[model samples]
Structures are given as C-alpha cells and as structure tokens.
Target: MAHVVTAFLRNRGRILLTRRSDAVGTYSGKWAGVSGYVEGDPNDAEDDARRELEEEVGVTEATLANTAQPMHITDGEREWTVHAFMFDVNHRDIAPNEELAAVEWVHAPVICERDTVPELWPTYRRVAPTLETVQTDDAHGSAWVSLRALEVLRDAASDAESWEVLVSFGRSLRDARPSMAAVTNRVNRVLADAAGDTEALCQRAAAEIDAAAEADDVASAEAAQLLRTEGYDHVATLSRSGTVRAALEDAGPSVLVAESRPGLEGVTVAESLAKKGLETTLTTDAALPGLVADGAVDAVLVGADAVLSSGDVVNKVGSYPVALAAARADVPVFAVCARDKIRGDDTVVGEEGGALYDGDLPITVSNPLFELVPSDLADGVVTEEGRLDSDGVERVAAEHAELARWDESTSSGADAGGDG
Candidate 1:
C-alpha cells in the first residue's frame, strides 16, 4: 500500500485536469488532477499537494481551499490511500511536464463526466466538503467544534492505528483553539476511552462530541428545570456557553446578553436567543452591573469553560464582575456546565489576545481569555450530575476525581488555585 496526494487547482469556476503522458509509469493518457506519491512527511499532505501541482503543472501560488480525509482505494493487487486537496488559484497558465501530456481547464461539475482515472469521483466527493467546512471564516465556538468533530469521526476506526490517527486529529483541533475549553474537554473526554476496548471508541467519541455540540440535550434540560424551580424568568448571561444557550432555550426565559467584549461572542448568544423568539436583550458589559443592581434580571446564569476542583469557574473575562454584581444585588449566579467540562483542576488563567486591536499604540490593551469566578460568588453549579452548591461543588469535584481514578486508574492531580 502507498499514500498519495491529489490537488485540484481551480480558477474562475474551472479546475485544471492534466492528462498523464504515455511515458508515465501508470495511468498513462488518463485524465486526472495534479497528483504525486507521498514523498515527504505523510502529515504534511498540503505541502505535498502543492509540490505536486508545481511539479506537474508548474503552479506555485495557489491557496488551499479545502483538504479532505484520506480515502482508501484498491485497484487490483495495489492499494492507495489518497489525500485530496482543492486549491484556488489566481492564474490558469500551466506548463505540463513529460509526466503530463497536456492540461485542460474543465468546469468542476463535468469532471466525472469525462474519461478519468479510477476512483477519482469518489475521492473528490470525500474531500470536497471538508474544504468548505474548514474554510468557513466565521464559524465560532460550538459550530466550529461540531464541524471539526465530523472530520475527526470520519477518520476514527476501531483499531490501534485508527486510535492513533484520531488522537492526533483531536490534538490538532485542541491546539488550534487553546482558549476553548469545550475543545479540550471534548478531546480529552474522547481520549479517556482510548485505554478501554477501542472496538467502538470512534463511534462513541463522535456521539459524545455531537451531544456536546447540540448543547440543548438532557443535561441542559436538567439545568433548565433547575432554573424553572428557582422561579427565574429573566436570565442574564455574559459571553456565550452552548450549555447556557440550551438551558435558556429550554427554560424559555427572557435573556439579557452582555456584549461580550473582545470577541463579542455574547452578541452571538443574544442573536441566537432572539431568533428562538425569546425576549433577548443585548446590552453592554458596563450595563450588566446596573441591570443586576436594579433587579431587572431574575438571576445571572452563565457558562463555565473549566469547573475547578475548588468550585471556582474559568469563564469569559467579564464573568467575575457579572457574578460580583449579581451577588451584591442578591441575584443568584449559576454556572450551567456539563460534567465533562469538569476537566481536572488545572491552573486556569485568562488569555490576552489581539482582539483588543493591533495598533502601534503606546498603550496596553488587556484581552484575557477568561477570569476566575470564585466559588463564593457563584451560588450554584449545574451539570449533568445535577445542581451543586459551593460546598457541593467541592464534594462533587472530589467524588468525580475519585471516580475518574477508578475508571482510568489515573489522576490529573488537582492544582491549587482557588479555595475549596
């Protein structure tokens, strides 16, 4: 078996198809996209795709529009697992090598309609949408997670080799967005099952991640019920939590969404709630304190990126102030998070980013990823295991840690940051 890369170079709605020269070793005179054997590190498929395009058609300045999961194809006694790529090119001029007889710019729709190499259409179909999903510039939070997870699931298999591939894929996604707790939580959650029988780990991991993306499932319903029990009809939330959004949707409460600064993720949350027909109010972060002080909000319900063992929550930066205001105004603050988000007590710190404006100014802009909401300020925490008070959070955290030890015979070891 051998690995290879196929790159489709597109310009002005047409893709370049090269006819393999009769002098080529195999598939001579067949219409195919720019392709070559995996000559370097297999993981660097994009580089290989670009290299093939340059070597075959003499194009070098193309942008990678999409990359797809590898597709395994067997032709007689030989097998090839092909990595496909789609590139958007600025120019159409091509210089065919001795290995390529000629190059034709054909419309993408009619590629399969022409005489072509074996399994070309199947390879294209498998890799096309991957580019579309990954190339989406505006996907954020859970939407991004869901899209990436599908790709991960597509690559998952029930063997050691497959598990390694999945783990590598998960790690890549996690590294792409370090500030996103959901990414780490979902990745780590799936990886936890790796030590067990991997017969269905891929499917199981995909199912778990899909449920996490949906947000409005049984766990959220339970959180919603807790809100209902508390008689909260108008809830205020800063930043966005898929879990919080689900709970708000299920509870059917009017929502006050703070314009989460830096990222403005809160605006997205507010828009989503408004579209659901909820009386959603979009306000500035400064106004949240006033809203809580005026008792305009029934309670402050938020989401946690990481729920620490000490019961402190690592959430969007402005969460601390909102929780503080809620406490001062006698408004209960609850963090709607799932049990998996209870990733072991690691030191959670707010991150600083370019969202504060990248100017050549002599002033410092503070853009932290999240701030700690001390356990005392957060009156309760709602997870799949049910609602836990400040003391209950510690109890649950310790219990969950013990359970994890029994499950995996390992401990992430609690990091001391906030009080228990």
Candidate 2:
C-alpha cells in the first residue's frame, strides 16, 4: 500500500483547502488539504506532513494540533493509505506552489458540499472536536472549548434532517461541558436566536463562532489595557488560557507561569509567551503562591472556566492558592474572559478526574480538575465590555438566564404541536 499525508492548516476558525493542479499525478483539480507521499517509515508521518505543508503552502511554522489513524482507500487496483494531520497556524498568508491550482480558507462544513477527493470530510472529522472530545478535553480553556462546541454544532447541523434533530444536537453540545458556562451560554444563544429553524440555526452557529472568537480578542485587549494603565509590570498565572496569553503578548508583561500539575499546561503557556519575546519564568504549582507572597508578582491574571453571578471565578485547580497569595500581598487579582463565561447562578460544578496514584496501598487519591476562587479574592473581572462590577456581572448573568430559556420554549412548542 502507498502511504500519503494530508495536513489541514487552520487559522481563525477556517481550514485551508487547495485545489490540486491538473499537472499533479492524481486527484488533479480536486480540492484537498496540503498532501504528499510519505517517505520512509509510517511512524515518521508527522515529519513528512510538515515537509508537505512547507512544500505545498509555504507554511514552515505551525503547531500540530491532532493526528488521525491511517485510512485505507482502494482506487482501482492501487491501494492507498492516507495519514491525516491538523495544524493551527498564526497567519493566513500562503504561497501556493504550481501543484495547487487555487487555495481558499473555508469552514470545515463547506467541504461537504465541495467536489473533493475520497474521504476528505471523514478525514476532517477525525481531527475536529466531537461532543466527546469537548467533554474530555483538558488541554484547552473553557472559552476555547466553547468555540469548538459551536464548530461541532455547525458540522452536525449540515446533516440534520429537521429542526427537532438540530435542537437535539444543540442541546447535547450545551450540556457537553457543564463546568464551562461559556459553552452553555453561547450554544443557548445560537439555539434561542435560531428559533427552531435548521438553516437559520446553521447560519447563527457560524456567526456565533466568529463572535465568540472576537469576544476573546476584545477581552484580551481590554485586559492588556488594564495591565498597561495600572503599570502591572509582572504578572503570574496558572494553567493555559489562550486569552491570558494574548493579553500578555499585547501588554508585554514579564510572566511567571505555574506548572499546572498532572497536565503541566502552564509549561506550554510559558514557552509560548517566551517565543513571543515576552520575559517568562516557569515555576512549579507549589512555588507560585510563595512567589506571589514574596511580591515577585505585581498582578495575578487568570482565565475563567465560569464567572458566577456572585462574581466568584471557577478556574483550573491551583488558582485559589494563587489568588489567596495575591490577596495577602495586596497584588490585584483579575479574572479575564468573555462575557459568555458569566453564568446565571453561583453554583459551581466540579469535574472529578481519574486517580493519579496507583499503588497497593488502599489510600484514596482525589483529583479534581477545577476549583472556585471566591469573589472577594478577586479585585476585578475584565471582559470585552470592560471591567465588570458586581452589578454588571449580575446583569450578564440575567441575560444568560434568559438565553437558557430557549430549551423550555422549544420543548413547550413541541408539546403544543403534539396537543394540536
């Protein structure tokens, strides 16, 4: 069997699809991701995928997001095995070689309608997040997961037979990450605005995905401004928050990131910030709070999994101690996130994780994925709408509550139709 690699380049919520030139050996004039024949052992497929991306689209630098198992396809007497890879790129500029007739960055669902090579949609599905992926994801923050949930709905809506089925899909996405208020709030907004229409729902889901991304951008900008205006030269954070990274990039603050245990997401964050030319320091989770108490940190900025109506922030485990240390040091602690993360209630749902310790000793090991930092511990909350006061948080929470009512409204409509 012949082995080949296909790399999907993603930027700003779209995938790059290239139209193969007629001069290519096979699948000429068909839309496909950056692809090429794999050289050497299949175990080294990722290197071949990167090499193809550089040759096909002039993309020399990109973060590998995912890889799928090899898919076998039979075209005539030739058997071919396709290896799929996905990359998240920072820029959209592309220099298409002669092998590509044209290139366009489009939503993944659009691939379904396009005349493409064999199993292109299936290959994309392998890299994209499913409901299960969203639920089990530990690498990304809630804001990131919420946007991915919208993408999941967008793809599902394309195949849904009726409005009822679409609603069911949206409901499943809304409940996929219970601790992620942004996931529930954003999905609810799309469902409520669509109002039981499939086409409208699809359109709204796409629009909301863009809006949600923009919201994070705006919130990051707001936080950056806060950092500059307040003269917070040194900031400390825990875990990996995309918005937090963006804000630090914009503000150019010296950063100390705690190595969020088990996952060590903060190591990734610290490396990313350092690459962006920011002064960065990596510390163990246990050392971070002490560093804050030593006045090494001017401010503590974190991304929220949920901002409760009571103004408390639910974030990755180990945030509370940092907040407490910041409070003791009189350093301002800010929770940064889009307004969609604000929940209508103060109830915090905790996710239990698998035991980290496996031994013959019968001691229980508790691994909670999240924890709550009381509202009093936070100095302020920064959002796209600016610094939100307690009243503003409550107002956003009320809006969220109203958006959540779409479920009741849809269910009632279905019951009324049955009665009719």
Candidate 3:
C-alpha cells in the first residue's frame, strides 16, 4: 500500500481538472486533479500538495482551503490511500506539463458528467463543498450537520458490536464539537438508553436522533406562536439560528440584530431578515442595552447552546449582557430552543483561538465562544414543551436526570431516570 496526494485546485466556483497524457506511468488519458505520489514525510500532506500544485500547474499562488480525511482505495493489485485536498487558486490559467494532455477549468457539477479516474468522485464526495461551509461559525448549520452525522453513525452502528462501538461512536460525536450541547445530549441519550439487541438499540438511537432533527422545525413553529401570544411585536436577537429564522417567518415581527462579533453571525441573520422584507435593524452589540432601555425593542430573544440544571443559559458570548440589560430595563428576555438543548448542567466555554487576532501579539487575547446567563435574568425559557420558568427548568432537568450531568465523568451507564 502507498499514499498519494490528490488536490482539487479551484477558483471562481470552478475546479481545474487535467487530462492525463500518455507520458504518465498510469491512468494515462484520464481526467483527474493535480496529484502525485507521496515523496516526503507522509504527515506533511500540505507541503506535498503545494509541491504537486507547483509541479503540475506551474503556479505558486494557491491557498489551501480544506483537506478531507484520507480515503483508502484498492485497485486490483495496488491499494492507495488518497489524501484529498481543496486549494483555492488565485489564478486559474495553468500550463499543463508533459504529464498532462489538457487542463480545463470546469464547474463541480460538470466533473461528474466528464470521464474521470476511478474513486475520484467518491473521494471528492467525502469532502463535498458543503463540508467546508458547515464548518463555518453558523450555529444552526453546525447542529443540523451534527444530527445528520449521528444518524449516519447510528446506521453504521446497527451492524457494529454493542457497548464498545456505541461508546466510541457517542464519544466521537461529542468530541467533534464539545461546545454543542445538542450533539452531546443527543449522543448521551442514545448511550443511556441503549438496550436490547444491537440492531434494535441502533434503530432506537437513529429514531431518537431523527426525531430531534424533526423537532427543530416543530419548535420553531411553537416558539413563533408563543411569541405572537406574548405580544412581542418587535424582537432583538444575537447570532443566527435556523429555529429563530423559522419563528421569525411565522411571527412576522420587526427584528433588531446585534453584529455578533468575531464571527458576525448576527450580520448574516440581519441580512436574511431584511431580504425577507421584515422591518430589520442591524446594530452593534454595544447598542443592544440602549435599544432595550429606550423601548426601541419589545423583547430580547436569543438561542441557547445549553440550558443547565441550575437554570442558566449557555449561549453566544454576548447573550448574557443582552439578557442582563433587558432584565435591568424590565424588558422580557426569552430563550427559544428545542427540548434537545435542555441538557447538561455544566457549561462548556469554548475557546475561540486566534479568531480575534493572528501572529503572537504582545498582549493576551480572550475569545470565549460561549457564556452563561443566570436563568433568573431570563424572563422565560420557551421550548417545544412550552414556556418554563426557573422552577420549571429544574423540573425538566430532573425529568431528564440521565442527561443532567454536572461533570463529564458523572455518567451513570444505562440509567434512564424516567420517561424523559
């Protein structure tokens, strides 16, 4: 078995595919990306990619965008581990060397229609363009993919050995995004309730994950109805949320959005609301308190990363301040989330490394990804289970005792507290 570097050089939404000339040792007259055998240290895949790009395309101005996990392929007598990479080329013009017949920039969709080397499409599919997009700081997109990934794992786990495989699968999903309580709670639920035959357990887990995915849509509708009932004609929000987006569509309220700093997720939210013709205001994060105090906003609405047993809400870094100001101004601040978010007592304040600045600065940079807002500061917690106060949050936490872990090592194996 050997390793090879296969890179897809892209620019302006098009990929550069080269036809292999007969001078190549193998796969002659085939359409493929700039690729080569691993000649240096195997761990230095990026360096190998840069070399391949320079040697094949005769260009040195390309940026590495995304690198997918390596894929192993067997071709009769030879097995090759292909390291797939996507590089953004500033200049698309390329002069093919003696190893290429022709080089053409083609759209992604056209690549499937053209003749290509074996496993090229499969390898590319592993790292679809959406993979890069989902990794963005978009909360809803990340949760959506996290659920999808769990469902995929559940399908695979159905045929896997019990206990160990389930544990490993759950751990992987939880570790993939530790700050995401939705993912952690969902995986933990499957682990907690895993029973009966392996196939049956996996099926149950898949159903639970699937139901959570479906509940996001339902929660949005329910939350929207709640907002209307509560007479929140104008809403102030921070960051972006799919559930919130759906609720806004249904509630039809004028929106004030904060420019969620570092990532600016709120900018995206504000633009989306404006595009839909909803009365929208895009303001700086510092202006949220003033808006609430001046009665410029009717209510402060936000999403939760995790709703703790202590009745605190863990969310975007600035959420606490907005809620705190709303509380001071006698404005109601409501956290709208699905029941899935109502898990875990511990708060995971993820680090936003280098998001604020790059290159070692003389001063320290603090970029905490999430923050905790005391539940009392929030007027109410709205979920598919309806609105809940701090007491109600505690009741919900007790009901799902299996998930209300204050620490990571406190999980009691196979202990389903009740009909949560």
Q: Which candidate number would show the highest lDDT if scored against the true structure?
A: 2
lDDT of 3 by residue, 288-309 (tens): 8778777888788888777887
Candidate 3: how large is its RMSD?
10.6
Q: Which ten residues in a row have the lowest lDDT in candidate 3?
A: 404-413
**Per-residue alpha-carbon lDDT of candidate 1 for residues 45-103, written as tens digits (9 for 90 to 100):** 88888888888888878877678788888889888989998887756788888898878
lDDT ranking, best first:
2, 3, 1
Give candidate 2 regions above 4 Å deviation.
74-79, 360-364, 418-420
My TM-score estimates for the predictions, one after another, are 0.59, 0.94, 0.64
**Clash totals in order:** 3, 0, 0
Cα RMSDs of all predictions? Answer: 13.3, 2.0, 10.6
Model 3 Cα displacement at 40 (Å)? Answer: 33
Clashing pairs in 2: none
Better of 2 and 3 by TM-score: 2
Please give the RMSD of candidate 2 to the true structure: 2.0
How many pairs of residues collide in model 2?
0
Taken over the whole model, the C-alpha lDDT of each candidate is 0.69, 0.91, 0.72
